[model samples]
Target: MDIGYILSGFAVGFLVGITGVGGGSLMTPLLVFLFGFKPIVAVGTDLLFAALTKTGGVWVHHGKHKSVDWKVVGLMATGSLPVSAVTIYIIKHLMSVGKEITGLITFALGIALILTACALLVRSLLLRKHEREVESSSISTGRFQGTTQIALTIATGAILGALVTLSSVGAGALGTIAILLLYPKMSTLKVVGTDLAHAIPLTAIAGIGHWSLGHVDFGLLGSLLIGSLPGIWIGSHLSARIPEKILRPILATLLLLIGLKFVLA
Candidate 1:
């Protein structure tokens, strides 16, 4: 029943609704810096939070647009799921060795936040560049094919799997960017849908793994969900009125500063 945590979740959800940024990029840091939660707990809680919140998006994408590419999702899952399990095993071993793992988690979280910030800043530019390339090349209907593209897509998923498991960030924004780059011909809707589809399982498994390690805080997770669900609904309704061009840079800058703080700490 912490009102502060509820409000924090609302704010993060509101921003995410408008910007389409992932909650982990915002919530994990908030839990650590604002609430003084351990990095491992914050990350674990946020992973389940992310998985639950994003579940709605998957159904929306599937029912309305059918934009999700199952093949790509399957390919990514092939790489991500095994790595996620392996990451959990490694973390458990580290903990058993009486090694300090919070520092590692904090470092990974910081790095992920910085990467997400850069992704947000450059997303529009990258899309524009992609459009230009498409126009110049007259390429239409870009789809994933060939052994190299398949390998790269799987590799991207593996990287994201490890990154998300460690930091509870990256499965959203970073995943989208990697998929967009790999499948340049995909529509934005498809890219988002595919990424989100992949993220559900990734976050769920990672969250469960963290829960098994006793890193997740259910009370905190409940408080966050209480506010975030409504906040996301309201924010999505209001998103059309916001100027994304102005908002993204400011958010990116905020993330950059926060990332530096965590990295330095």
Candidate 2:
């Protein structure tokens, strides 16, 4: 593994563990803006990275007996998976025909980044309103059987699938926030756990699609993974000790700047 890639993996992994917002939001952008990866390649690689990294989280949560609302995850996947498949098919077709899609990918990435920044800011606001939850960890769920809510949940999943496939910048903070808005009564621990669980299949499917399209770089993926494992462990431990009041704003600002650079470039 390249030392630089390992370092990047560790940094991004730790941030994701600590802030719950870095897997795609930070890593994809870093690949594009910092490491000069093509937008499509960066997104594709990061999608796999997210899948691999979060798989471990799922195991840990299960081992700890943390609650995961399988019904909700199923509902969301019903919408996300099919849409993701179609999106990748379209992308692969375009690529096969030598279509000029860079503009499309770049534009999508830029928009996704901006949206991620907004989501991060919104999470901070939500946490501020619920002061006691600022340091709370884990995710759990409550009942929501309303037809409207179910439809909305599926719709959210569809949107998430499309966005993540195109930009690799959702299913992390964005998905969690969507879950929170949909089920405010659910346990925060469940919400996060569910989100994390859903992300793995969602990203893994999308990553496989990208791989078929030849957008994934396995060498780079290996390097990033090497560092991310340790980074995430460290970040999870450091989270309770760190002040959100300091970290949130800084991360938000960084996202905003990077997003603007992409869109306005």
Candidate 3:
């Protein structure tokens, strides 16, 4: 057993717990840059790692009634599932052409990571704005509804599916931002819940597809899981004691650095 890989996994899991971002954004890049794994293998292994880790989170959230928006989840799945299938087909074709698909995927992952970071930063700003607006005005007791919202949700889901399938990024922070933007009236907890619910199946399906294509490294994934499971538990237990003001900026800085590294590599 490679203790280094396990320790890396623990570090990534701790970040995920601290930020609520998926492991792929951090894990895939770490594998590629720090461990010198091929980009394709890093992405494939991280997808499986994300699917497994998020499945447990989804279950816990469901048990607590705090992690799902079934209708929104269904809509996202409807759009994302087909897009994911198409993305895998395209990746397989690129692989068949003997192209440097890993480089392309890495580049795409870097771009996606940067975009997710921006989305997170913007979301924080928007939430602050919304809170201020609410403080100045009476709160409305209405839910968002309209063709525009539905269409936007579907479009966001499609984009997430393609990005995630190609780079294993964008489905966590990016997805949540889409939800928050589309339905500002909804509680933040609900938005996160719905996003997680939708991401579980989407990542699982994509991960399985990558596995079938022989992209995933089972040993690496196992090693990651061995460390991440306990790390997540510990992080979650300690989360409330930590201050978000410090965490967000640090996470954003990490994402920015990793994104730049991947893009410039």
Candidate 4:
């Protein structure tokens, strides 16, 4: 048990729990761009880290009966699982070109980060708008059900699957936004819980695929997990104490800086 790695994991995990952002979105870029991890190794390790962290979230959500929308989860998994497999296959095959492949992966990751940032920005605005509308409305609504909504959800899932495999970005804030947009009638809490539930399996399949390709770094994964578990526990406990009005802006700023760094790197 490397104390340092454990601490780092704890920190990342805490952020994930507090913010409901996918660890991969933050952890992968942090590992590669800041910590000098190889791009593939960073991606692989982060996938596993994401899987491990989300596992706990899934369990808690399930135990409380608040972690899922089975229909939505099934739809997402239907599209994502195969896409993840295909994306991994492409990466593995492309790596035959060696260093060039790594460069490509890094570029993809950068683009994904930028996209994720944009998604987060859009989500914030939409949620604000939704909040305003709800306040003005005399009644609360139930889940959205329509052809357009279903189609959009499936499309969003497909996009997330592709992006997650390429850059490990879309599964967090991005996925949540898609859900919010497609199912505006649902409460925020339910959306977040359901999204996390779906992400667990989606990430697990993708992470295992990466592992099979010999891309994952077990030592790095171990370190991240050690740190993230406790970090998440503390973050979850403190979530109510923090003000979203303050936290949202800070998180948005962080995302902007990170996105810019990746683009520039």
TM-score of each: 0.94, 0.92, 0.91, 0.88
How many backbone clashes does every candidate have?
Answer: 0, 7, 1, 7
Error of 2 at 235 (Å): 1.4
Query: Stretches of candidate 3 above 4 Å error?
Result: 131-144
Candidate 4: tens digits of C-alpha lDDT, residues 89-182: 8887776656366766677777777777677677778877875222121113324556655666677788788778877667878788877766
Residue lDDT tens for model 1, 1-265: 8999999999999988988885899899899888999999999999999999999999999899887888889989999999999999999999999999989998898999999999987786776676522221111333555787778888998999999999999998899898777878777777888899999999999999999999999999999999999889988888899998889899889888888888999
TM-score for candidate 2, residues paired by index: 0.92
Better of 2 and 4 by lDDT: 2
Order of candidate numbers by TM-score, starting with the best: 1, 2, 3, 4
lDDT of 3 by residue, 5-28 (tens): 999889888877877874788888
Count of clashes in candidate 2: 7
The 10-residue segment of model 1 with minimum total lDDT is 132-141
- Predictions in order: lDDT: 0.88, 0.83, 0.80, 0.73
User: Which residue pairs overlap in candidate 4's backbone?
Assistant: 6-227, 9-227, 9-228, 10-227, 10-228, 14-231, 14-232
RMSD in angstroms between candidate 3 and the native structure over all alpha carbons: 3.5
- Give the best candidate by lDDT: 1
- Per-residue lDDT over 140-197 for candidate 2, one digit per residue giving the tens place of the 0 to 100 score: 3223556877888899999999999998987888898888787776566777788889
Please give the lDDT score at residue 155 for candidate 2.
96
Off by over 4 Å in 1: 129-145
Given candidate 2, what's the lDDT at residue 204? 95
Instruction: Return whichever of 3 and 4 wins on lDDT.
Output: 3
